[model samples]
Target: MVMFAIIPYLALSAALDPLAPIIAGQLHMSAQTMSLGSGLGNAAYALGTVLAVQLGLHLPQRRMLLAYAALLVVGSVLTAVAQNAAMFIAGHTVQGLATSMLLIAAVPPLAIGYPRERLHTTVMIMNMGIFGAVALGPFIGGLQADADAWRPLFWIVTAVAVLALLLVVLTFEDAPPANPDAPRDLPAIALAAAGSLAAFLGASELTSHSFLDVEVIAPLLGGLALIAGLIVYQYRAAQPLLMVREMLTSAIPVAGVVTALFAAAASVSATALTASVLSETYGPVRVGLLFLPELGGAVIAAGVFGLVIARRSLHYLPLVGMILLAAGILVFRLGMPDSQPLALLGSALTGLALGATVAPALFVAGFSLPSASLPRVFAVVELLRAVAAFMIAPIFAHFAATVTGDLNEGTNIALWIGLGLALAGAALGVTIYALSGARPQTPDLDTFLAGQRPAWYSPPLLSRLRRSHDLDDLDVALPVPESVD
Candidate 1:
């Protein structure tokens, strides 16, 4: 069921770049519009995530998963057959919602069902779908986009989605235990979904233009208000949809947010900027082909990091990725005037960097907090990353529009912007690693989830992973033992 749930995103993420140019051509719109569509899809995905968290509390898990998977099949068809931009967006939205719900619902059961010691590794492997999609999606989807019209690409997506849905129905058998302590609230879920959608739209719009405009201001402000209300309601309501306390204080949540920002920034910047420039420079077929090395790199890196590297040591992996990304992007930007080969090399390096870093970050984020909090915290972080992807892409586009005299010039500006983000994100990762003290490794999840503490405590799981990877011990800054009683 879990694997099936992530299949659409895997296919979509890779295909997104290739698909954008076709959509733009058909719609007779600017690349910015295509960028907006990407943002919209991500925003819808985030909305689905938030809703899934609440759905788990109130609804039957087996039924919800089944419904979600069915939606995926339908949404895929809608996307494939869409004649206009509106239909495309609608299809993307439905897929986004279904994808999120399916993915989120799969987690809690795993947490409760699996042994604590193996949870981190288990989740990490499962999350490879995100990376797997990124690595393989572009190549497979790109081929279709290259050979046939873009419309056919949707058919492919539909087929994959249908297959996934069927697999889910066959595989997903366990049902969640009824939680008498947790009550469901319909109103709260609705408010959160609406607020998230508004916020994503508003945030995304801000990238292209000023937030001061009426169109931008209204959605942004309204979304903020609704989200604010959500928080207040959660705090006061009998049964809250979000696990606010755990989300804020947990090491995992903090790390996840930071990780998502950097990971998303790296991959999103690469794909969006590359798509925009390459569509004009190389044409769609070549542009899709350009991502081949990237896919290979991401797959190899993710496999090694997930399978071979210990979880704790993986924190620094993203940092390493950022550095490679910066280097690749810098090379691509500076060398663009020189040759296509240079740009290709740069793309390869960037793909390799993303491959190495993104999966590990997600693994850490997904497994860090308690099982109960996974969906909500992951949703929030994913949402923030969506905000970044939407907000950053248009900024790059607008910069290209104003500063550049030509497509190449605009690409240069976008590349530089991407490099800057990579550097900044890398630096933040270093700071986080330094602050997290070294602790001995434990095989049990109880240690990580242990809210109770002795008078004196030590650093948690991060340090253990770091040491296992032979990284230097981070200095202890906070008290080791947190007092629970």
Candidate 2:
């Protein structure tokens, strides 16, 4: 069931990424138009987190999963039969939205409901579900691109969606909502969707129009402003939709969110840029072959995560992952467009970094909160992650294509930006570890959830910052620990 629910997103992404050019040519669309479709689809995926959470609060879990699966089938069919760019975008958007909704609705129960001894298995499942699928994307995309057709891939996805729907029906089990009477946060959903749409639309326009053009500037700025408002509103609402206050108050959770966002943005953008440059130069099959090492890297990282997940060293995992991610970006910045071996090495390293960091950070966030809050935490984190990671790809693609007259030079420039984001993310992870006073040794889940302040937490630098911002007031009491077994 889990495999069926999650693999479709990976299949679609992998198929679309390498085949973007083919799809564009077949539909008589520009690369920018294709990017717009991809960007909007991803944005819908990100924003759908809110909808998933809302529905989870009010709807029966199994029924919602089934509904989401049905929507996935419809979306995949629409994409398969799409005759124009608009139809394609609409279909892809629905696929993206439905996939995320299913993810948020289904995954948390597995994470929280399972026994503590089984957590390693849960983490492995997450790594495979997210990164494993991503690792396979290029291979699948390359094969289809080599075949010069996309409808077959879409048809396969339609079948997968159907399988997922059937799995939901066969495995049906009734589960009550976490809070059946929780009021819906309509404003949060509206802002999230609108902000994501506008931002992605603006970024997509950058392909055909200059960054200064109103089409690019207005939506970009307006969307950012709306998102800012959503944050403030979430912070103040007594029953916030996304638990913004809880995230902000905790050092570990803040770091996890930042790591997820920045790492995703950097890695996804780099992949898009490199794939674009390489596919044009060497063809899609060869380019896809180049990225096969990522699967190995993701597998190795997942193994490492399984080993350290229950130990205190888990705190340091994200930091190490971020460092690796930065190194990967550097590899691309230094050797892209001219060095295939270096690019392959970079791909493997980035894949390892992703497998190492994002999921571990998610685990950190989940453990930081009580079990009851797990769904909300996952929803909020995934929302921000989608916005940061997926939204940036099209913008990076636009820049790589047009930042300069030379495509290689343009890609190089974008790689530099990605490198900066990677380094920044690494530094943020370090800050989080330092601020939280997480030890190199692994602490028990209870110690972590207690929000223990580090010895250095009261040092002059932090004390002054805490005083200035009155951060102490935001501290939340740890819930009574629940027995894991």
Global lDDT of each candidate: 0.64, 0.79
The runs of at least 3 residues in candidate 1 whose Cα sits more than 4 Å from the true structure, single-residue gaps closed, are: 17-39, 83-86, 107-128, 137-142, 177-180, 183-191, 202-213, 217-240, 308-311, 403-405, 433-485
RMSD of each: 7.5, 7.8
How many backbone overlaps does candidate 2 show? 5
Give a tens-digit lDDT track for model 1, residues 198-239.
766765565456647775678877976886677677657665
Tell me the deviation in Å of residue 1 in model 2: 1.7
Question: lDDT by residue for model 2 over 175-283, one digit each (tens)?
Answer: 8776888999999999988988888788778778887899998998888788778888998999997878877776667777888888888886557788777776787
Q: Could you tell me the TM-score of candidate 2?
A: 0.89
The 10 consecutive residues of candidate 2 with the worst lDDT sum are 453-462
